[model samples]
Target: MITTHAAIEDNIKRYKRGELIVPSDFRGKGTENAIKKTLSRLAADGTIKRLGHGLYVLPKKDPLFGEILPSTEEIAIALAKKEKVKIKPAGAFALHKLGLTLQVPTKLVYLTDGNGRIIKVGKNTIRFKSTTPKKMALKGELSGLIILALEELGTDQIDESTKLKLSNLLEKENPIILKQDLKLASAAVHDFILKLILNK
Candidate 1:
């Protein structure tokens, strides 16, 4: 008979390096405590890395960096994929991603069409805020990030320099996709972005 620990270990090995793991992934192999214990044992032996409560990963090895732990963005993307949810970067993080800001935010925030939750991974915190389906309907990568970043800056805060930067970015986006995504934006954002698109 295969022991619970052995069974769980085997299942974990099937995952690719840097793949996230949760106890629920081993549901049928053992009882909840046995599964948790097995995961803890593996993490203790360096076979896997314990990220935080209920999160583990098969650490990827890098030549220079040694252990290649996942970034907050990577973790958020993985969690969204696993949960079958849609997520887009929001707030200060969105601004930073769009080159509107140079500072890196310590806490990462994403708007999701799924339940809102906070996950702490090492020094970083990943926040998923529940949002409407329309907000999640953005089809263009550049357009989505621009909308979120603009929302973070707000109408009053936008200046000539910022508008210039946005205008430059708008040139890189596909006109068709940008036009389609604009329909999903709030009235203020739609009008703001349309003005830029029209001026281009």
Candidate 2:
């Protein structure tokens, strides 16, 4: 007879390295306690790495980086997919995603329609902050991220080079979607984006 731990270990072998694993993935294979215990054991044995509470991944080894782990953004997006919720990059993370910032933040923040929580993965932290529906309803792919970054920086912090960078970034966005997203922006952001669009 296959032991519960053995069965789980075999199942984990089928997953690609770096794929996200959650308890729900093994729902019918064993009891909740059995699965959790087996997963903990796997993590302890270096077969898989525990990311946050209830999150695990099969470890991937890179020649230069040693053990390659998923980025914080990837983990948050995976969690949102599992929970069937929506998430939007916010604050410093938004800036970093837009290439407006050179340094990666130790704490990544996202706006979500679901419950807010914090999860620490190694030295970095992922924060999901509950936000209003309106903020989550942004239309453009790039425009929404730009709005978040600008809001975090505020109007006073924006400078000539920053505006130039934003204008260049805005060039790649769909004009219709960009215009639609501008309506959702704050007064300052709306005006700023409008000027960029017009100047384009």
Candidate 3:
């Protein structure tokens, strides 16, 4: 029979290098304490790097930079998993992710189905804001992001250049998927996405 550490190690081998991991991911695999002990040993071995409280990651090492830290998105995804909720980029971060904004947001917000929580990682702040079911309906989809980005930019504020870029992105999506995802948006956001799609 495989030992607890061996089994945990085997399971960890499946995670990509630099992937964030939490103890909850090992649920049903072993006792909570056993998993924690195994993780502690692995962390000491430098096989995994411990992040904030209860957060660990298999660091991605670069030849010149040594171990690279995980991105905000990676950390946010881990938080969402820990909270057992779906999350999506919100406010200026959504526009930034889409290359519409050159400005990097100092604080990142994610609309989540879970309770609001705040986490500080390095110099950045990650916040999860509880949102209605409709706001989170397409949390995992491309269109959901478009809605949030447009909401951040507002219709009048979106310049011609931004509209062109947004239009081009919508052109690449499947019509059926786009139509389905748009249903999750509010009426105003839906109208904006429709305009972007039709104008492309």
Candidate 4:
């Protein structure tokens, strides 16, 4: 068996240059204490970042830009992956991603099938709100994003320009995927999406 220190070092190589690291990732790789010690050492040496309570990431650097920390969305997605859970960007973040808005919300929200938690990275605060499986059905789909953005702004708040923006976005999505996403949206949002795509 490899030594404790060596096991942690070898495991670090498994992550990509900018990938996030979580404890559960090495559950079976080595003894809990050994892995903890190894990771602590790396963090102290500035070889890796301690993002939060049990979150860490291999920081990426650019020659011109220097260190580039992971974005709130990236960190959230990584956490979901490590836990084998589903998470979809919600509210303002969704609208921003879909090109419907330019404002970046202070708090990034994600509807998740996993338990709720918050992770703070600099000025970005990532929040995971536990939601039902039904809501997470389209986690990675564009339609899911549309629904969240629409819900956040509300039907009454959707201006003509915003609707047009959504129309253009829907036009670019694969027809089959659009149909699948429509099936997963709420009834009102489903009708709205149909109207947008059909140009009605």
Q: Which residue pairs collide in model 4, if any?
A: none
- The alpha-carbon lDDT assigned to residue 17 of candidate 1 equals 94
Predicted structure with the largest lDDT when compared to the true one: 2
User: Which candidate has the highest TM-score of all?
Assistant: 1
Tell me the spans in candidate 2 whose CA falls farther than 4 Å from its real position.
1-3, 28-31, 61-66, 195-200
Q: Give candidate 3's whole-model lDDT.
A: 0.80
Error of 1 at 79 (Å): 1.6
| TM values, all candidates | 0.88, 0.83, 0.66, 0.76
Over 1-200, each residue of candidate 2 has an lDDT whose tens digit, in order, gives: 78888889999989998888999888888899999999999999999999988889987888899898888878889888988899999887887888988999999998999999998888889898998887899977788999977876676777888788889999998988887888888999899888876886
Q: lDDT of all predictions, in order shown?
A: 0.87, 0.87, 0.80, 0.79
Tens digit per residue, CA lDDT, model 3, 97-145: 8777898886898888888988777778888988888777763355667
Backbone clashes (count) for model 2 = 0
Error of 1 at 101 (Å): 2.2
> Model 1: per-residue lDDT, tens digit, 103-173?
87889999999999999988889999998888788888788888876765576678888887888888898
Task: Report the error of model 2 at residue 67, Å.
Answer: 3.6
Give the residue spans of candidate 3 off by over 4 A: 1-64
